[model samples]
Target: MIINKILNVDDYYFDVFMSISESLTGFSVNELQSTGLAEIYYKHILGQIEAATFTEFLNISKNILENSYTQDQLNNAIAAEIFANASTEDIANSIITLWYLGTWEGAYVNDLSYKEGLVWNVMHSHPPGAKQPGYKSWGVKPVNSNI
Candidate 1:
């Protein structure tokens, strides 16, 4: 008997995270996973829930991970807010900023994933019909190629 393999929820989350990161930053899982910011964000996600709720937590985590923030601006804003007794307005602003940051990051990740996916699709696609003499010549060729 043969056993079929299936991706677990955690695996799926990681896959999605990697895909988004690659799309946004051109970094692979191995490279980005250890980055200081990524690690901090990852720990934040991991610490917020138990194992049983991992799948549900993953959606929110994914959103956070994929969100983008300008390093300089985020650092400045964080520094300013670090010692202040934040008011409701400040808190609201912070939340809004974070949400926007997440969206920006998500878009970057999505764009990179889209670009990589397009490349992959083009590389592995099948023509609608039988292979023709000129079928393989359709893609963008190198300038140096003597086609």
Candidate 2:
């Protein structure tokens, strides 16, 4: 039930983000947004830290979305090249890195909130202090891992 306040766009924008993220990260929206991570990404791109921003990243992503490509197009090598190159852009790369590591661009900025980071999700491990895997399961595989 969380709503976006920064961009003021409708559901389509989130859908775009979901689609792009699924393509890039190979994770479902239900999986990725379970802890409101995507919205945080949107906030980061909009104006979280001002100088630390991704307006250009969002623009390039939206431009790709605007192109005449089908959902299947994102999986192709050409589109992969575009995404790969776009991710090289400062903001876009940070976004991709965040999607993978679930942290902000510490290489660029020191502020990083790893509360719901994707690495823990993918590794089938819970956030260190938030959700304990269970009793004495430190090295055991997570019971509910989707990866």
Candidate 3:
């Protein structure tokens, strides 16, 4: 029998949370990491939900990731396994909202979170106040903007 020894427990949990977030949000690990909110989100989740529920959710996510064969299969598994349950669904939804809107339960985590929201990038734009595209830039078609 192999023994599991995790010296850095927080890091391990963060890794698992990140993997689950990647699957739930359809974003790459790098993209999630780029936001610099992985740890913050993890902490927020831990604070918002019970520890036992979060642990079980992580385990289910691990199993789903291990068993899934394709994107469609993974999505199906996620919907059936995660979204079907009320507690897990709440957590999953919160995670998605956090990524897209940079808020947890309708409250922004921080200034960086507002600026780094994935929705802005998904639309090939930046936050309104932060990262302004320059004066009158909107009048001309953006170069190489696929959108």
Candidate 4:
């Protein structure tokens, strides 16, 4: 049987958020060995990103960054805006993580279940050609393996 695939906004937000965060922080996606405050901040940023799609998150983050808020303050502000009505901490955390990831300069496609054909199509459409300098690479692969 063929499995129907539907893209989730939260997943898209997470991918984009990670890309942006890496760009802004100058950290490789796999090299973010964060803990404590950095970890907390990451979570919050992700939350904000997950709460909104790429375009919405970008607009919100741009507005916040242009203001005088510190990184922490900006993160919280984004969380508040994204989770205006939601009360779940998990959702909030996701939003925070999303925001942190969105700071970078690339698109994210974190859906593991996506078909290879579909992923390639999306990647080609967004980037249009070979990978550019300072942008995260996109493709399909396992995050970890024990083979």
Best model per TM-score: 3
lDDT of 1 at 81: 36
Residue 48 of model 3 has an lDDT of 80
TM-score of each: 0.23, 0.60, 0.83, 0.27
Candidate 4: C-alpha RMSD to true structure equals 16.2
- Provide the global lDDT of candidate 4 against the true structure: 0.39
Model 4 lDDT per residue over 1-147, tens place? 111122233343344444434434445444432311334334544454554444565554445445524657655665566445353333334433333332222333232211211223323433234324234544444345343
Q: If ranked by lDDT, best first, what sequence of candidates would result?
A: 3, 2, 4, 1
Query: In model 2, which residue pairs have backbone atoms overlapping below 3 Å?
Result: none
Question: What lDDT does each candidate get?
Answer: 0.37, 0.57, 0.82, 0.39
| Candidate 1 lDDT, 1-147, residue by residue in tens | 111122233446555434334333444445444332343333333454354454443443344344425545433443343214344223233222222232222343222223233223324532234333265556756445698
The per-candidate count of clashes, in order, stands at 5, 0, 0, 28
The residue-by-residue lDDT of candidate 3 on 65-109, one tens digit each, is 778878888889999999999988988998899999999888998
Query: In candidate 3, which residue pairs clash?
Result: none
Best by lDDT: 3
lDDT of 2: 0.57
**Of 1 and 3, the candidate ranking higher by lDDT:** 3
Ranking by TM-score: 3, 2, 4, 1
